[model samples]
Target chain A: MLWACLRFPQLAFDALRGTLPNTPGAFAVVAGPAQRRGIVFANAAARGAGVRAGQAIATAQALCPHLCLLARDPAAEQQALGAFATLAWRYSSDIHLREPDAVLLEVGASLKLFDGWPALERRLRDEIARSGFACRIAAAPTACAAQVLTFAHDGIALTTTAVLQGALAQLPLAQGGLESATVTALHGMGLRTLGDLFRLPRAELARRTGPAALLHLDRLRGHLAEACPRWQPPARFARRLEFESAAHSTTALAFPLQRLLRELELFLLARDGGVQHFVLVLGHERGASTRVAVGLLAPQRDAAHLLELARVRLERIALPAPVYSLALQVDELPPLTPPHRDLFDTRAQGGLDWPALAERLRARLGDGALHGLACVADHRPTHAWRHTPLDPAAPATRDATAPAPTANRPFWLLPQPLVLRTAPQRILAGPERIESGWWDAHDQRRDYYVVELRGGQRAWAFTEAGSRQHWTLHGWFA
Target chain B: MFTSTADLFALDSLPASTAWPVAAPATTPASAPASVPAARNTAALDTVLRHPGIWRRRAPGTSALATQPSGHAALDALLPGGGWPRGALCELLVEHDGLGECSLLLPTLAALTQARRRVVLVAPPYVPYAPALAAAGVDLRHVVQIDAAHTDTHWTAEQCLRSGCCGAVLDWLPRSDYRELRRLQLAAESSGTLGFVFRPLAAADQASPCALRLRITTAMNGTQFELLKCRGRLGGATSLRLRA
Candidate 1:
């Protein structure tokens, strides 16, 4: 099986840098127990000023007086690595996450789908870089070999087992992924490179360094099987971002919100689905968390569009307190159906579609502000029509089976019939009786007539049965 | 060079410039024919007439404006383009409600909805009776109603008109100024959608930026329409015998 491994050499620095709004200044990640704290990774600005990794924090500060030191966060690093794996999940399903630094994917089946290795490699590199991560990639015949090759060199591709074996032999014993104690013991035996150890007899090597070292060598050489648990994306997406400091205004939260949205986008891509509804919980410094729920008419995964919708919704909310952290949770992700496009679609390019426009209007207005009209196929004028949710996919045609009204109907109907105190100037037409809803409790027996008001406005006036004096203005012919 | 002042007025002595029609021929080279300059002038005039802002009357039975028929023969004859102008805002100033105001637009709205184009009603005063609309041949599924506040009525209509997905946006604005009408007009023009705004008759005297404005009142036999402002024609009035 062909395997591709991506190693993040500066994962600690990269993970922390993504959280900050800007990283133009000199920065370094210092980790280790309190007394031996040293620079694990230094950014370009610090490196330009002679700051190097593994140097004590004091020495690094001396080299660059203004170095901004951040303690290494292992949780954030693992989260960053999982995000990268989620991105690579689009390329292959058989993915294994190596602790601390690397991830391996069996890309044998994906090579054909991606038009071979070089194309896939270029795509992986471009996407990873766009996601704000620096990675060293290598490929070999086995997963373990591929992981080991990443330390030796970046962009190494060994297709066959013989070639992989030959390449692995040239690497120093330190890059063999062995424990430091075992490597020290092997070094004491005059073994400079992996090829020197390979020349020794198997029984003798196992007697000297124990069976674990032999198993490691055998796994790297494709002799023993390496079983790593496959990483599965969670059923639901829930990502949280803790602010370096409490954000007072909503504007201060836009950057972290955007980063979380980007991660949500990658997560949706991995699942090959779209989100119709998601909630953004703003963790405040005091009181309960504020929840901003964004609902769309259709499933959507575009980050920019989602961001715009979220921003519009956020503007209407009043922050109860300064937000200390933010969380994005999407419980239900429906399958996305790509819109159908004709060869010559007359729609304006880059203009919002119907669903997007409706969402934008509803984002500003309340949810119940917009509705569609549907004929209810009833005899009562009030019960003849109902408001429905606007669905663009439904055909814009009425049911042909419903019987048409014989009498003339007014264009506008009042929500409640208004009582007309005075009589009309003239009657245009006689009463067309309507006695409907007998089976239901709303029994009505009314005689409707077309009447002309004093100022020459037409009205739909109706009177109860056996009473012609009590005329009620039910509708307007506007 | 030492000639009298009268020599400057002479046709032959006048400097050869396009501004002076008589001097243009003298500036022409001997190799070119006389028809070239005349053709160039006609081409320049054609360019000016091609602009949308420039209104020019065309020959009878050869109209150049894009319009949707109002479905009434007499009313269509009174309009400049033989019907309602497309891609522009039209204002209907009603003397009062139920003066055949909704009937005036039922035909055009029906035609648009039948073609599967969306028609949005923003802040309508009353419920648009579905039975009447269905009998009028309007597709019910294509009709969307938006209930917005007084402040957001114009904004919602402008957005629908500019969305390009809508074929018509009908709005009822109880109160609005010239700036709001101007914004709606621009949005309709950009998206090439029909926009109809209904205002009270009192606003008829106020200057509006809509492409067309009509004042509807009741006549002896039927409804009367006075064309207060049409983009390319003089004001005229017509009466139609429409059913209530």
Candidate 2:
């Protein structure tokens, strides 16, 4: 299999930097114990200021007094690797995540689908660059060899096993991805490159550096197939972004939220599905996180539309405390069936669809703000209709066969019946005796009448069965 | 030089079946046939009449404006195009709520919903009775009710109108100025969706950008309508007895 290995040489620095807004500054990532913390990665600005990796935190500060030293987070680095693997899944399904920094994809099958190796490579590079990662990619017949070549060369492509062997021979022992102890032992014996080690007697090499080193060499040469555990995408998508500083307002969180959303979009693309419900947890400095639940009427995956809905919801929320991080978790990604389009149907050609518009309204006005109307088979006016959630997938299953009511119903119903103080001028049409709802305990035994007030406004008034002197205005014909 | 209006009318010799010209005829050559200039003038007239914005009195029914019958014969007779104008905002200034305001447009809303087109009700003042709407032959499935706050009513209405997914958007704006109405009007025009804005009768004297505005007040038997503004013609106080 033709495997492509993507190595992020500065994953720790890039992962943390990506979470912050774009700004030019000397930054360095320091790791190890607090007492012996040293710079593990230094950005270009820091390197220019005479700061380099492996320097003590104190020394780096002395070199560049204004340097921004961030503690290296292994969790963030791991998350960045998973995100890259999700992106690579779009190119091929056979993905392998080499822990800490690299990912290998079996692109031999995908090359034809993407119209050959060069086009596929270009697309992969473009996606990597757009994701803001410094990646060194190399291809070989074996996964181990591809991973090793990434250390020796950035963009080397070895198609055949013979060419892969030749390339591996030129790679220095240090960059051959062997155990450091074995590399040191081999160096002590005057072996400068993998080619010198390969020429040694197999029994002698095994006796000197143990069998694990020999096995690694065999896997790299394709003599022994590497069984690296294939990476399987998690069932649910969850990504988090930590702010360099506490975000005092929702507006300050928009940029980082956008990045997480784009990553979620890529994740959805990899899964070939859409998300109907997701939650954004706004992490505060202490106590509980503010959770903003975003739900859609239908499955959606478009990043811009999702961001718009999220922004509207974000604007309405009052942050309890300054947000320090943001995490987006989307469970249950349903398969998306794109709306069918007819060539000649020009209605809402380029505008938002009905579901999307409804979602936006609901996002701003709260979930209960928008609803569909459904008529219930009840005699009581208040119980005659119910509010139903708008479900676009469901067909209009209106009960057309239901018998029409003999009496005319008013167009508008008041939430509560109002007691009328003045008497009506004349009676128009009702006084239909209605007695129902005994089963639900909301029994009503009233004679409803259509009456016209002094101003000629038609109103629906009702009186208790025994009392015609008192009338309650229940509805309006308008 | 063509001086009299009759002379300009006399030069209209192009066939009625001629297709609309794709582009305005370039500057006519000096030595062209004498009839060429007359044909160019006729072509220009055709272009003007074909514009969707323009209304022609002679062929009122033939104007390229979509309309839905208001279901009242007397009211339709008074309205331009013989019905409620589609793809344009229609304003109804009500003296109060229960003067057959909802009944006036119930027929058009029913027709839209029955035709499988969605009808959005944005921040309606009251809960529209479902049984009455169903009894009025409105498809309850296609009716969406959006209960937005007073501050967001105009924005919600504009979004619904501009989406083009809804066949009509009906909103009640008790406190809106002319600029807000104009924005809704433009959104409806662009998306070709029917928009209805209901306001208090106090704003009847204010200028509006709607295509039609009718002031309804309680009459002897039913509701009386005074046409304050209609896009194509000078509106008159045409009274019709709407059934209660």
Best by TM-score: 1
Q: How large an RMSD does model 2 have?
A: 6.4
**Fraction of native A-B contacts kept, per candidate:** 0.76, 0.85
Q: Against the true structure, candidate 2 has what lDDT?
A: 0.85
- Model 1's CAPRI class is medium
Indicate the DockQ of the complex predicted as candidate 2. Answer: 0.61
* Candidate 2 lDDT, A1-478, residue by residue in tens: 8999999999989999866668899999999986899999999999998998899998999999999988888988988898889889899999998988999999999888999888988898998898788999999999999999998788889999999888889889999999988888889989999998899999998999898999999999999977767899889988777777899999988888888888788788899999999999999876569999998888988898899999999999998899989999998999987766668877755567787888888898898898888877778878888898878788646566544743488989999999999878889876788899999999999999999988878899999986677899999988
TM-scores for all predictions: 0.83, 0.80
TM-score of 1: 0.83
The CA lDDT at B153 in model 1 is 94
Candidate 2 wrong stretches, greater than 4 Å: A9-73, A129-134, A162-214, A221-224, A234-253, A273-291, A318-342, A345-352, A396-407, A422-424, A466-469, B1-34, B50-64, B95-97, B201-207, B234-237
Q: Give the DockQ (2 decimals) of all models.
A: 0.51, 0.61
Q: Residue-wise lDDT of candidate 1 within A65-180, one digit each (tens)?
A: 99999999999898888888888899999999998899899999999999999999999999988877889999998998899999889998999999988888899999988888
- Supply candidate 2's per-residue lDDT for A347: 74
Error of 1 at B244 (Å): 8.4
